[model samples]
Target chain A: MTTTLSLEQEVARLIVEALHLETAPEDIDPEAPLFGDGLGLDSIDALEIALAVSKRYGFQLRSDDERNHRIFASLRALAAHIETHRTA
Target chain B: MPAEPAFPLTARAPGEVLFRRGAEPVTTARFLAEAAGLAARLPAEGPVLNVCADRYLALLGFAAALMRGQVTLLSADRTPQRLAEIAARHGARCALSDTPASLPLPVIAPAAEAGPEAPNPAIPAARIAAIGFTSGSTGEPQPHAKPWGALVAGARAAAARFAVAPGTSIVGTIPAQHMYGFETTLMLPLHGGGAGHAGPVFYPSDIEAALAAVPAPRLLVTTPLQMRALLGTGIALPPLIGVISATAPLDAALAAEAEAAWGAPVREIYGATEAGSIASRHTTREEGWEPYPGVAFTIGEEGASVTVPGLPAPVPLADRLEWCGQGRFRLAGRLTDMVKLAGKRASIAGLTRILTAIEGVEDGVFLAPPDLDRNPRARLAAAVVAPGMDAKAVLAALRERVEPAFLPRPVVMLDALPRDAVGKISRAAIAALAWKR
Candidate 1:
């Protein structure tokens, strides 16, 4: 059977592709945040990549989402949120 | 006036080439040679259209045409249709184009090749150089004619503010056809103290490369969106004496981010479609901009209004502002950029920022339809990327931060927004998006 990737692996792939980030997916740590100190993604990039995720993954993130902190916490968390939802 | 500033005096003599992307740096004699070439080629009486891809060349063409006593029509949008329209409007018989691959429009190339040559060319000031088009934020782009003397005066005022010196390399990433870019990169090099890169730079990486290619004490003239994108890239940039950002609002947060990321203060210029440029802000420390020296102004004007040279027509600014001493004022958001909700009011710009701040929201924008004027409530629509989240959830969050009335109703989720050439969301586009209900 074809192997299914973990949430972390999937999210890492998404980040690399969405941002054109010059890094290998495996290089991304599951514990690191996607913005600020971790990946240093700015607000604009956040919006751009978020849109990408919505179109490709069929999931939307709302502004002022109380869970924003956790949702953006790390690759693991984002992957988890996506795995739990993702329509497209 | 003051003995016309002599050209080809490279403080960094024999060092760098005059133009980079697609222009030639020639001695004063060379600039005139190219001008003379065009003059010889043209039928002395008709207006000339300048489609020089290289911004520097366009400036030179403008000057050369003026000296040869020809009227120059400058159009920023060089699409075939627009070019044809401009050519017809001005009865231009020929055009100067840097792009060899461009259409056959009797295009002429500059005689000077791109490079560094030791030659001082004396150019007479006071010639009527060229015409420039406004950004068309308010409506259709209007043309503003400038005399050589006027351009020189404007550049002198700008140079004094920037404090650039001879041989100080200034690189531009913005299209030179625009007034702000023309003044900073082309005119500044000719009449003021610095040397400018030969071409227009458009990309973030190009901006970085331009900064490195130009020697120390360099200046970068760019728009706010480009500035934001450059910062987002998180690339290392060379030491910039200053970064000139215009063509849009330089929000305090964005400016602070730029300063923090680049370790250089981003100086903002207040300019528009009508006026070339009149005031500038060195730091966010002072709320408003200090006017370019020798320019004066007051607040209110209805129509047929006149203000200082290099300033927009004397229309009451769309936004309120706090004035500093003469020629300086802090811009509050535009008055028209605001909207009212049920017993509450907020700036659309503010809502856009809040929406953009959402996690996993790529390229989200809040927009209100023009028909909302019939019932100007806080009714809003938005194109968003938060795929998993529904419109109700989006509204719920907006309510938490902003007033409930200001919460967007009937949020329209779309794949993307229609941003224009400069990444600006036009009112028409917004209204069009709001077409359905």
Candidate 2:
């Protein structure tokens, strides 16, 4: 039987590929923080992820949106948002 | 008595656009009225630290302080420690910012109140206007004070050099606190009778959006780091007359590519926090610098120093240069940036240039091993962010460009270099990276 990757795994792979993370995709904890002390990612990284997600899922991540802090809280959170709103 | 010019420096026709906030255009009359209202409300006692992230708010705070005769303190670092230091220096507990809670000081938000606009205060040319904090690339951030007259003169010179005309609008990707952004984005518009986009754009798409929002002919003021990111995105920007870059070394290849992509020539401004804007060069056309009109440079065995009309003393620059007379010069390298290895010499700046110029290298920096004082013969090290490229391959590429002795001993691959908000890779950060290896 073929196995499909979970949303968390898929998003982790995307993050690693997009940001050129030294850590392996499976090594990234799903609930770990993605900003500040977590991954040491910055505003520029966030924008890159937003652009990549928009291209892959056909949904724009607006900077001024109130839920930005919540959506970008963790990889799991971001993946869940994409799962709900992704058009493509 | 000498005749005093207009206090605010900029007074355009009421309908003339002064700035664009998002998609909305603000007229000169409205901006002046708002600035006058805010100036009336500013505290007259202490130096005001302007930390507003919003470009429009920052500009308003700056103008308000100038009109109030309070010196504006420009710091690129928004850390609480820096804010506390600035507040303690001014002997005040409060600061002026749009986001009050972000700073350590007791925040006094500038005026948004409805009232009669006050007349522009008569500000003297020699009055100390603002203090700029250095980028801390070498050591601790040092304070450089600038008077109103010096700032205005520098702005006029930059406007002429960049060929910024009355209808030109600027969209800057740099921090407002830095000298380059302060000159090109804020002072140029106020003194040169041009409009500026009030958006602090970072992302490529956002920069494209910001550029499209402003009317041409537009000028994109950016740093090398931001320009690289913008170029990578392959987004189409609006029609531009020219692009001005500063705050870091812009590679010639990148300059040519940018010029080709945007259909506008790329000009680089060369100056420091102490001297403000002094010279310009078309990066693709020349390796030498053309000093601003009325500006002269004195190069000696010590280093290069510049003298401008408004400054009281000649400010020594950190770079070594070979003066090619007739108001032009070629930069040899940074004065203190030379590294000696195996009885051979190379500049850290030159090594960094070769590293970043390598194809597929996104961002990179070189550092003399942190224990250099203990062991003067310590080899160079680097932190690079080139995906799909191994350390050995990167070293191989470096070997082709520089002497083998100057090559990095261990090239640590990272996702990104730790650059500050103004795109300056601090020496401390570099030392930490090298020590990690």
Candidate 3:
């Protein structure tokens, strides 16, 4: 549980840093959406996050991967996907 | 009377594949049959609001509208307010959508199956096939009507300029509803005799997969923003015959990089919704834009107005152009307050209006700082003076009013905006306030 929480926090920080969000990483709700209504991120931000995740986790997040809707749904989901797919 | 030129200016074999939807090849016969079937069910009168998410469905809706002699309104903005405004303005009777959602107008999902035989209807050249809307400076959408003949002519000109041969698969990263995407991806395949990849290809990996799904001699129709993202990923792409970019200016270095990396020439189209592709340039080799065949640019004391072959009158150009020799010209600068980001355009003044309209927003200003690197991901920033409201609240209000692309990020909260004696916030001042944080 601690490891999962830490990974989610790490992803939150990565997203904040990559997207240059005004809010602090800790302020981001783990369950809230990373796009549209929540953090107001758009498709470009999604690409930016994908690139950042690939660089950090050594895995590619393809938009048409079918799991992308779940992976990018929130910080927790993204962190979990990274946990499973990260080669590094 | 002179005989009216029919649509689909180029002849295509009935068995030739015109579009690739997922793994399925949609032949010319299948496309025409589907369009005819959809056309039979369309409203008898008034224009149609086509908001189909799928590229293939959007094209079918467009062709169906064209067959019925009804103008199709193409807009990427699907907000209820925007749709309502369009419906009110054009008296749109129904909307053609693939997604299951409610809209201001009656929604019609185009699921028309292909019939046994294709219908080769003779569509008049003078028919207003589509009306593309651009976000006006006054916060209203300005409609630019495109005739079928003009679209066909523009597509053929582009095909010739880019050397796009028949059966070449065209993959696009931009939406089919945008003017550039519509012309390059959708219209190009129809009139240019190329096949279009008919799924949403946004992310870099998706673009690669879509390209891999298509056949050889592929042409990529995309904007500089998407191109930048695609290149940034460093993802391996299938061999491309050529790449055509528009909506935003393509930097020479990036163009050269793409040409070198992909081993294909990078071409850019200079056009607007008002005039569907007017000129083309081999970005890596040429600095000046050469007008397409039969298109003439007259530079008068007022400004430059382009005379497209099929348009009724000359349309004034919004960009200041410096004429070289022959039919080539260089873009000087934009003459409007419009800022384009990721192929979506919005006026700064209009954005400011939306910003201030929000309750508890005392004063605000939006600025798109000139990105020296021309980064496709560059976004609009804002500084607002809202006493009791937080940035999230302000943004939430803004989200309802503007498109996601135009939403100003980092809504800076200020005690007061720096205004001069005349109560005007200069561009320099806005830039400083917006970017300083």
Every model's DockQ, to 2 decimals?
Answer: 0.04, 0.18, 0.47
In order, the interface RMSDs are: 17.6, 11.7, 2.7
**What's the lDDT for all of these models?**
0.61, 0.74, 0.82
**Candidate 1 local Cα displacement, residue B13, angstroms:** 11
Tens digits of lDDT, candidate 2, B1-437 = 96875345564566788788887887767777788888777766658888776677788888877767788888765556656766676655357766535665568787544346555455677788888875333223467888888888888888778777888888997767767788888888887757887775766766788888888788888866566666765678899888888766678888999999999999988887789888889999988899998788999998989998678899998778897766689877657776644323456777788899899899998888645422323567888999999875787687555544556765788887887889887667767766663
Residues B1-437, model 3: lDDT tens digits: 97877775235677888889976899888888999899888989859999877889988998888778889999866666787898889999999988765677888999859666756677788888899988887778999988888988888888888878887899987778888889888888888868988777877778888999988988888877667777777888999998989888899999998988899989999888889899999998898999998899988667789999789999988777888876699987766677876566788899999899888999998887778226667788888999999988898898777877778766788888888889787667768766775
Off by over 4 Å in 2: A1-36, A41-88, B1-7, B11-15, B111-114, B135-139, B337-437
Report the C-alpha displacement of residue B248, candidate 1, in angstroms.
Answer: 0.3
The full ranking of all candidates by DockQ, starting with the best, is 3, 2, 1
Best-first order by TM-score: 3, 2, 1
TM-score for candidate 3 (chain B): 0.93
lDDT tens per residue, model 1, B214-279: 677777887666666566555578988778877656667778888888777789887653456777
Q: What is the lDDT of residue B223 in candidate 3?
A: 75
**Candidate structures ordered by lDDT, highest first:** 3, 2, 1
Candidate 3 contains a number of clashing pairs equal to 0
Tens digit of per-residue lDDT, candidate 3, span A1-88? 9999999889899988888787889999898877666776776687788788767887677755242566778888888889999997
